[model samples]
Target: MHFAIVGAGFTGAVLANELAKAGHNVTVYEIRPHVAGNCYSERDEKTGILLHKYGPHIFHTDNEEVWNYVNQFTDFMPYVNRVKTTSQGNVYSLPINLLTINQYFGKTLSPKEANDFIKSLADGEIDEPQTFEEQAMKFVGKDLYEAFFKGYTLKQWGRSPKELPASILKRLPVRFNYDDNYFNHKYQGMPKNGYTPIVERLLDHANITLHLNTPFSSENKVSVDHVFYTGPIDAWFNYNAGRLGYRTLDFVREDHEGDYQGCAVMNYADEKVPYTRISEHKHFSPWEEQERTVIFKEYSRKCEEGDIPYYPIRLVNEKTMLNAYIGKAKKEKNVSFMGRLGTYRYLDMDVTIAEALDASRKTLDCVNKNKPIPVFFVNPL
Candidate 1:
């Protein structure tokens, strides 16, 4: 069977590779000139430092299958993401570890002592928290919430914490121990070269054809047995239902003589600060050495037309519109919606690849059994 893949990101690339390996003709369309989508990385002309064009993406996953799958393409260097945040005019470790707690409160407390102290600070009145503010207050109390989360959340989402859901805060961890590793995944590292090469290898199958700078739309006519779309769901239907809300990012790049922030990522948790975080690209790949460095200051705002969508704002309004699009997608024939944008969810790199692999397996099974392909392999909601 012939397969048409929209967008050359990880999802489309993985699907194309799998189908091609099955002796099916696969064609991939990428609107961007480059592959890998947001994970695209390249070396700076002057500094010779590898820069993540969109933002820093650390490959961290507890899934052993995902770790082994990506390893087949490129060598991964040993790298753990240790993030820092500047809040209240002081630098502190992120994830609100024991060190941050002690430094902020001016007390050297043991793990047990710190846990009890934080519990005392937490508001006991809120039995069941609904909003982000309530969740933070119930978890770490008002002091830490205001100093660490409030200002930064407002800047990143462009909305007050009270307006957001508690589920957003649930993803962030507050550890009593001094472990500052950003993620708790078993496997964590960056590609030895860059993500682009890994994706290039994924699409290098003999039966796969890649078309860069080619946009896919419902209007375009294609002679494929099936279509796998990884673009925004609303875009597939031309936003007939309504546009789903998303927060887009703006990156401001700057060059420096030596190390910039002395870290891969340093987030600014102060509302007064214009940018949320500063990422020093050279620091990302510690295996390589460079005299010069490059940094990108990140700012977030409401996504507009033609802007690349980063985080999906799955508020009440967006959920309603997303359901409508999902309905339309299900009614379509010979089409499957996959990936973060298609499903309208914030997906990690590992989850994205895992889902793609599962979708490919399901597709192959359906084809072999002479059954109809599923519109969605996994539930979006």
Candidate 2:
């Protein structure tokens, strides 16, 4: 069977590779001139540093199978995502660890006592959290939430925490211990060369062809036996129910001599600061050394027409629009929508690959047994 993958992100590239390996021809269509989508990385000529074209993406997951799968393409270096934050002109550690708690309160309390004190700070009257603000207040109290999450969340989503759903805030960790690791996944590392090479590896097969700067639509969907669309689901149906809500990021690049920010990521917790976070590219790959460094002050805002959508603002209205798109997708024929934009859910790199692998495996099985393909691989939609 021949497959046309709509976007060359991890979901499309991995599935393309998997299906191609199983005796199928695949062509990946990407509007962007490059592959790997948001995770694309390239070398900076002046500083010779690998720049994360979109933002920093730390590969962290507990799944050994995922770790080995990526390792087959490129060697990963030990990279710990130790994030720092500045709130109200005060600098502190992230994930609300012991150091942050002690520094914020101007006291050196033990981990256990710190945990208890935080529990004390929480509003006891609030039994159930219905919004992001409520969830933050319940978990870490008002002070921490205000200092760390409130302004950032507002800037990231372009909405007050009260207007957002509780599930959005649940992704953040409120640790009572000294563990300051941004992600709790057992396997954490970064691609030694960059994510671009890993993606290049996935598309290096002879049977696979890549068509960059291609805007795919339903008109071109007839050649392939099945379709794996990683583009926006609403766009697939020509926005019949209007566009979904998404937040796009604008990166303000600044070049500096020596180390900048002293860490990989620095969250600007104050509302006055326009950008939510500033990422120092050099710190991501510690093994490399360069006198000059570069940083991207990330400004999040509502995605305008023709803007690169970074994160989806899945508010009530957005969800309603998404459901309408999903309904249209259900009625469609010979196309399987997968990945974040396809399913209208926020997915990390690991989960996207896992789902794509499963999808490819099932697709292969169906062809062998002469069965029809599915509309979706994962059922989060």
Candidate 3:
């Protein structure tokens, strides 16, 4: 069977590779000229630093299969994403660990003392959380939530904590002990040559034909057995139902000598900062040598026309809009929705790749048996 895969990101690339390996012809249509989507990286001409074209993407995953699969394309360097936050003109370790708590309070707090202190701070009345703020307060109390999450959440989502769902807050951790590693994943690293080369190698197969700077038309389907759409669900149907909600990013680049923030990621957890975080590019690849460092001050806003979509903002209104699209999606015959935009959920690189692999396996099994493909590969709603 021949398949037409939309977008050359990990979703499409992985699907294309799988189908091609199964003796099926696969054609990938990428609107962007490059592969890897947001994780695309290449050597910068100005300073010879490998720039994360969209932003910084540090590959971290617990799944051994995913770790091994990614390693097939390029060698990976061991790296831990040690993140810090700048709030009220001071720097503190992220995840609200014991070290952060001690530093913020300016007291040498023991594990037992810190635990009891936090318990004292928490509001016991709100047993179940309905919103992001409530969930955060329940776990870490008000002071920490206000200092770290509240302002950043407001800036990132463009909504108050009461307006946002509790699930968003659950993604972030609140540690009782002092462990500053941002991700709790067992395996965390980066590609030796960068993400683009790895993605390029994934799509490199005899049966795979890539068409860059090309967009697929829903009205005119390519001559293939099935289509796997990694693009926005609303865009595929020409926004007939309604436009799906998305939060886009704007990167303000600044050049600095020697070092910028000492850490790779520094979150500005105050509304006064304007930008949510500043990602120092030099810190991303510690293996390289460069005197000057480039930092991208990230600003999140409501996705606009001709803007690169970064995060998905699935507020209540957006959920209603997404449900309508999913309804239409179920009735579709050939195409299947996969990945973050397709499912209308924010997925990290690990989750994204895991879903893609699962989707590919199920899709291939159905195709081989001449069975109907499922509407949603991984359910978001």
Candidate 4:
């Protein structure tokens, strides 16, 4: 069978690889010149630093199967993202650990002491927390929320934390212990040769043909047995309902003589700081030594028509718009939606690969049984 895969990112690349391996012809159409979507990484010509073009992407997942699958493509170096955030001219460890708590308050606090202190500071009156601000106040109290989350959340999302959902703040941890690792996943690493090579290798197959700088529109649609769209769902339908909300990033590239931030990611939690975070690219690849370091000061804003969408702003209004698109997608024949943009969700790289693998397996199974392909392998909403 022949498959028309849209957007040569992880979703399309992974599915293309899977189907190609099964002796099916796959044609991948990538609107961007690059194959890896947001995870595109390349070495700097002058600095020799492996730069994450879009932003910093740390591959971390508890799913052993997904880890092993990515390992097949490229060698992954052991990397733990120990994030640091600056608030009110002070730097502190991320994930709100005991060390952070003690440092912020200027007191040596034990795990138990810190836990009790935070609970006491929490708003006990608000039994049921509703918004992001409420959830943060309930978990880490007013002080921590205002200092760390309030400004950062507002800058990142371009809205007040009170307007955001509680689920957003829930993803951020408030730890009593001193563990400062950003993610709790068992498998955490960055690709040795960078993310682009891994994705390029995934699409490199006898049965697969890739077309870069090719936009897959209704006018230029290909004749294939099935279509796997990794692009935005609303865009596929020509934005009939409305443009879903998304937060796009503008990276201000900088070169330094020595170490810049001394960490992979240094987040600016102060609203006074224009950019949200500054990521040192060389720190991402610690195994390779580069005297010249490169960094990106990331600024987030509302995604426009031609802007590259980074994070999905899945607020109430966006959800309504997404649901309408999903309804239209379900009615389409021989087409399936998967990945962050297609499903209209904020998904990690691991989750995207896992879903792509699952979608491919299900697709192949249905083909063998002469059953119709599913509209969506996973629920969008």
- Using all chains and alpha carbons, the TM-scores for the candidates as numbered come to 0.99, 0.98, 0.97, 0.98
Which candidate should be chosen as best, given lDDT against the real structure?
1
TM-score of 3: 0.97
Give a tens-digit lDDT track for model 2, residues 32-85.
999999999999998999999999999999888889999999999998899999
**Which of the two candidates, 3 or 4, achieves a greater lDDT against the reference?**
4
- The models' CA-based lDDT, in order, is 0.93, 0.89, 0.86, 0.91
| Error at 357, model 2, angstroms | 0.6
Ranking by TM-score: 1, 4, 2, 3
Candidate 1 stretches with Cα past 4 Å from truth are 218-221
lDDT, candidate 4, 123-236, per-residue tens: 888877789999888877889999999999999999999999898866558888989999999999999989999999999999999999999866445578788899999999
Lowest-sum lDDT 10-residue window in model 4: 217-226
Q: Model 2: residues >4 Å from true position, as ranges?
A: none
Model 3 C-alpha lDDT per residue in residues 1-381, reported as the tens digit of each score: 878888898888888888889889998989988888988898878888888978889999989999888888899999999999998788999878889999887878888998888888888888889899889888778888889989998899998998888988775576778898888999999888789987898899999999999988764365777888888988878888777778899999898889988988999999878899999988888998899888899999999878878788887788898889998898888888888778878888888888888888998899779898887887778
In candidate 1, what are the lDDT values of residues 1-381, reduced to their tens digit?
988999999999999999999999998999999999998988777877888899999999999999999999999999999999999889999889999999999999999999999999999999989999999999899999999999999999999999999988875588999999999999999999999999999999999999999998655435888999999999989999989999999999888888878999999999999999999988889999998888899999999999999999999899999989888999999999999999999999999999999999999999999999999988988
Error of 4 at 58 (Å): 0.6
